[model samples]
Target: MADVRIIGLDIAKSVFQLHGVDDAGATVLQKRLTRARLLPFFEKLPPCLIGVEACATSHFWARELTKLGHEVKLMPAQYVKPYVKRQKNDMADAEAIAEAVTRPSMRFVGPKSPDEQSAMMLHKVRLMLTRQLIMITNATRAHMAEFGLIAPVGRGGVDRLLAIIDDQTDERIPAQARSCLQMLVAQLRLVKLQILDNDRQVLTLARSTELGRRLMEVPGIGPLVASALVACVPDPSMFRCGRNMAAWLGLVPKQNSSGGKERLGSITKAGNRYLRQMLFAGAMAVIRRAMQGTRRTWLIRLLERRKPKVAAMALANKNARIAWAMMMSGEGYREPMAIAA
Candidate 1:
């Protein structure tokens, strides 16, 4: 047990599978420990390298394990999948994690701190409330439209419809519809307030640091993007280049090459979906403004040939690269110079 140099841990809510290999790459320990016994077992073991798959609770365990004088590496689940030998089981997964973490070229996910997780939870809650608002708003609008009461198609329109519902003598909508919509309207108001609160919190966090301010200087990055980036990424140095960071967010194109011929397709759509969604939203804001002018941006040039949606994606990719570069360089965004006439 003392000579075991590397252990792969398959973490779970209750039982944890541990596969420990000796210095010569020989299996020395294959054990399953209950949740309560897990930490004490490691506490008695000498300092060594521990490998685990990066999943739910993996970061918490990794953070805890690190405090035990052990070096821990969290491998992405996809990267470890190839190592699973025969039948799939907790032991096989644990062994696979052990093998994958030993590979020289394997990429590992860094464990996120408690604060990072908390901020992500905030973003998640905000998104959930926004979705609920959309559902109720759409249902109310559709239901009211059935009774010959129709309005415009935005939140503004929803507010107008709510006003109509509140009016007792509006004969267009039946009383039953008014009753049903009243509940939805109340829920909508509550959700709107909650969303506003989340936005204010994000904005406050963004302005709390000079780093966030610098990030916001980048085009297409607002308070939400700036704050989310700060909370999620603690070290930009993990990526070798700006494009690497962009690619990690699934902004870069996916590729398939054969016989030295390169074929590129849609983006892999991997990595953090929330960050990607935020970047795409920011890009759309820029595109909305660009539509009003004939001013040729690099984006405008692309828009001339590619579709507006494609152009928007290209701009989002560029913004991701730019944002990463700014984070790495600690420099504020500099406006691009006009192309030589």
Candidate 2:
């Protein structure tokens, strides 16, 4: 450990590989350490630059390493991929990270705070539970339909079934079918309760933050969307402009350019899927209100002439830009120009 200046750590659950370089970009140390020995190894070394990919647990370690006085850089995995040499291995990957972090133009991800990570984990749990509940509900409905009994679409149908089960004199449903419906209704109720709890958690988290408060001023950005945005984007300054923010969120269209002609395709859909989905959902909500004359201006007028889904996506992109502006400018959401709507 001859005054290591830069160290690249290839992290894993049990074992970690380290590639250390001196001030002159010469390999000074290459070592493997178990999870238990990682901190101890770094504890003996003077504070230096450490680099890791922005994957699972990266932020946690970044925060930990920062606390230990090391400068940590979390690079996106894609950005480091090009640096990989002819063969890819833990040692090679560690070396690539070492090399990548030394570049003057390298961009690194800002490590998310504990609170942001917690909110993100809650959102993930809520999404998983909601998907499971939907699957159960659909399976129950399909099973019922096979017996010449059709369950109506949407939650209303589930409510109707629950009411029938509670009724003392309803004979339309057979006993066995009633039993199954009762079971499903019970499960649905449990899931709905969990969803309410998750929503409350999201709201509670959102209400305690300045960014969340500002985001609330934006139309259609409720507790969930605000919290997700806050969690996903730890540092808005990472983006140079609103368009950079939109591109980071994968709201921008993919471009295919050849010769002198340029064509743009659908959104890249490359970043956080949960955040993108929440933004799209918020946009759809806004579009619904816009459709009802809530805002009859240029954007709305243009939307009226295009497919609703397309308009919704366009609105989502606009909302991403506005969000970026609000974050960067330290201002609340403002209505777009009257003509632009």
Candidate 3:
């Protein structure tokens, strides 16, 4: 094992496969270890380079292995897929990771700290609760519409529907149906409260870190977006530039360029979907405000030439780049000069 210079670990809940290579790029170790045996084996092994595919628990293992003096590199699974040489299996995947890690051009994902992971978990729970809230609201609306009861839309409309459900004198909804719908209403209200609580926590997280506070100064990046970015991305220096960071978020256009001809399609929509979605939503909000404000910003100009959705995407991409720059430079966002309408 002393001859081993690099190792690729294919980790699972119970069993793990390892592929180790020597300085000469020859296989030195191929072994399988159970969850209980995994750490002890590594603890005994001398310090070496370890590569792992990023997944749910990859960061946890990476942190643990690093504590044992191993240099751990977390690579995106998609990037490691091309290195597979044969039929897919845990062993093959481990071998592929071992090979990929030594490549000069390979990309690596930064392992997230426990606190960052905790923040991401908070965001995930809030997202789940928000989805539940939407589901309950839709179910309530559907049930009420069956009895000729209709409301406009949004929270105010939902509240109006709830009011009708509560009115005992209203003959539109039968008592039995009203009781069932009230149950949905109660769930909806509870979810809203839970989401509000999540928002407060996210706000606190955003204020806790200097980087988070700087991120919030960017247009369209509220407490939620800022917090997620801080949690998901621990090292901004991994990206060479703002555009690379934007590309990492999959905001760049997909290209089909060959020869000298260039053909670009829609945004790749890869990387962290939550971050992309958050940025797009924030861009829409910014566009809405820009439309009402007296400033003639770049987004407003884009809106004149392209559809609103297209413009929103462009704005999202720009915001991602801006956010990356802010994170890298340790600087606050500066408002660009805009012409008066």
Could you tell me the TM-score of candidate 2? 0.91
Better of 1 and 2 by lDDT: 1
lDDT by residue for model 3 (1-341), tens: 89999999999999999999999999999999999999999999999999999997999999999999999999999999999987999999999999999999999999988899999999999989989988898898888888888899878999899999889898888889988988887888889899999899999999999999999998899999999999888898899988888898898899999999999999998899998999999999988888888766677788889988888888888988888888888888888863232
TM-scores vs. true structure, each candidate? 0.94, 0.91, 0.95
lDDT digits (tens) for residues 223-258 of candidate 2: 898888888888898989888887887888899989
User: lDDT (0-100) at residue 132 of candidate 3?
Assistant: 95
lDDT against the true structure, each candidate: 0.88, 0.86, 0.91
**In terms of lDDT, which candidate is strongest?**
3
Model 3: runs farther than 4 Å from truth? 338-341
Best by TM-score: 3
Error of 3 at 144 (Å): 2.1
Steric clash pairs (candidate 1): none
- What does the lDDT read for residue 188 in candidate 1? 86
lDDT head-to-head 1 vs 3, winner: 3
Measured on C-alpha atoms, candidate 1 has an lDDT of: 0.88
Report lDDT (Cα) of residue 205, candidate 1. 79
Residues 1-341, model 1: lDDT tens digits: 89789999999999999999988999999999999999999999999999999898998999999999999999889999999998999999999988888999998888889988877778889889989988988898898888877888777798888889889998887787678889988998999999999888888878988988998987789988888888777778888887888888898789999999999999888888998899899988998899888888778888879888787788888888887788888888888872243
After superposition of all CA atoms, the RMSD between model 1 and the true structure is: 2.0
Q: Candidate 2: misplaced stretches above 4 Å?
A: 162-183, 337-341
